[model samples]
Target: MEISWLEQVNADVPLDDEWLSSGEQLILAGMKVPKRRADWRLGRWTAKRAVTAHLELSSHPKQLSAIEIRPAATGAPEVFLDHQSADISISLSHRDGTAVCAIVPSHGVVGCDLELVEPRSDAFISDYFTTEEQTLIAQSSQEQRDHLATILWSGKESALKALRTGLRVDTRTVSASISDGLDYAIQDEDRADASVIGVSRGWYPLHVRYEERQAFEGWWQCIGKLARTAVSVPAGGPPIRLSGCPRL
Candidate 1:
């Protein structure tokens, strides 16, 4: 579906597992054979409701079509429409109180992540922090801990997913740093987007663009570390914005 990422995010839809647990009779009806599946059905159901709002469709949510997930060898999700071979690019993310479903045609090989703020154990930071990251973490001011880690974690995870686009770069090999004024870095501010430069073959060959949209308030530590981040990278050259998704 051709829709703006920003507009779809603002559309209201029900996300409660309880409300969707029984399945919407009108949505699933009697298409039992293959449609009764779990995440596929529920996720699609939720997606349709949200998409419908973005499309401003007068049709009931049940009238919306079903979506199929096609994954790459490494496990990336793409939407396969029955009517066409091209899979539309869609990104899904759910934090605590809310979940977001975003889609961009083929070109939108976008990956998104959300995290809440919370307290943490000292050893927690050591688990994922590389030497450089560890230095940043230790030296970070008390007030800056959550914000600092969130940016690094988000940028790292987001970039990790971005690398899925072409090359399966090692998570340990590449790292991210954020700064408001520093070029090729991100700010530790909520909902701020950053452009990063990373090493590929020992050189900072390309700029990796990533965005951070704070999902909720408070300091979120474990959730921030556990939540998977997605990113896209070019196979052979600089990453280019995909115009649309490819046919599966």
Candidate 2:
């Protein structure tokens, strides 16, 4: 099935709680940490907007209030419309004021992640990544090391989310690798619009192996210093941007 994705930043979230459902409001009120509350709001806002766009529903605040995103027992976000469960699978990730949501058909499982391309300590690589993943990073040039590491890490997180275990499972249980010989260059024109970032670069195939077995297939792309990855069980097509949602 075709999976759709949307991106939103902190500025895109509404300041008022009018768009949040009663349950969501209660959850927000219970969050004592300001940063956690802000991140939660940003994630919910992005997921609601993505669901509306994917389902072709109204974008009005009142309508959005009826669509709630609640955590399942496994901590995966589940969509609900007017207090009833919606037949859709969604995954969310927020980092550094930016959030992304991935929507897929109900029959399939999906997960997505967004990460900034930054230096990771050697200890981190050894602690979380598989031997092969570390070797790939070590082979990368100094200039590309950060970007490659981010992609691999983000892919692992996405796969973990798809497995519905998140960080509860060992990250090394899953190994991520990019397809061979894929061009990573981004043209100047593509950088002119910061919001569109890597969309123009298109999606590159990513494979994630769980315990040495091929378990999830997905795609990854990078632009500037941002990397996005999405993986799904039963596999999915390259993520298509959901219409009517704000850009990153």
Candidate 3:
């Protein structure tokens, strides 16, 4: 698997239209919001770069713009080379000028989510988390509460993405169990009671990973951090490991 990251997208930076395929050009041209356009462009840029790095493609094999990503019927991103589907599974998430792409072999699926480390409201937690997860969070020390809560929430999102439903599923349907050092076990909706959760079903034994990126606090200061989490299918097999953080 390969992970790519890009921080602080600049709206003014000129994007080379030649780097985008014909289908991508239409998607880009149809956008009306400036910020939305920048995010869409940045995500494609990061995903293409990731695909190139994974395939180890030299400039001769293909041009960067030749790769294209389009949505499948389920709305999961699909990679195409010269407008043909490539045998690869991918997941994407971005927020607050930050973007990330996680790619893996087509046999299995993967999902990733980025979130800022901050306090969450009681109502938000109560509505999204199960009773067991809430008890675990309450057991943590005061200082660890924020980090733990954010990570748990991010983990749920990642699991949903791996299932290709994204946030459309109820957050409470998925449960998270954090052990040590950001390692967690996810019992997807399948583990839930069918009658209570409305017959929700998904992959089981999903693995969860947590990582953070340092945030710059001042001109010469970098003190804060952003939390990120990911989940993948075929859980009992080889664990999905994260690579080094990408440079901003």
Best by lDDT: 2
TM-score for each candidate, following the candidate numbering:
0.52, 0.92, 0.73
Residue 30 local lDDT, model 3: 99
Which digits, one per residue and each the tens of the lDDT, describe model 1 over residues 136-173?
Answer: 76787776676556655655655554445332554444
Best by TM-score: 2
lDDT of each: 0.41, 0.86, 0.60
| lDDT-superior candidate, 2 or 3 | 2
Greater-TM-score candidate between 1 and 3: 3
Q: Deviation in angstroms for 41 in model 2?
A: 0.4
Q: For model 3, how does the per-residue alpha-carbon lDDT over 18-52 read when each residue is reduced to its tens digit?
A: 66777788999999998898888877776766677
> Clashing pairs in model 3?
19-65
List the candidate numbers ranked by TM-score, top first.
2, 3, 1
Per-residue accuracy of model 2 over 70-103 as CA lDDT, tens digit each: 9999999999999999999999999889899999
Clashes of each: 17, 0, 1
Q: List the lowest-lDDT window of 10 residues for candidate 1.
A: 194-203
Q: Name the lDDT value of residue 67 in candidate 3.
A: 90
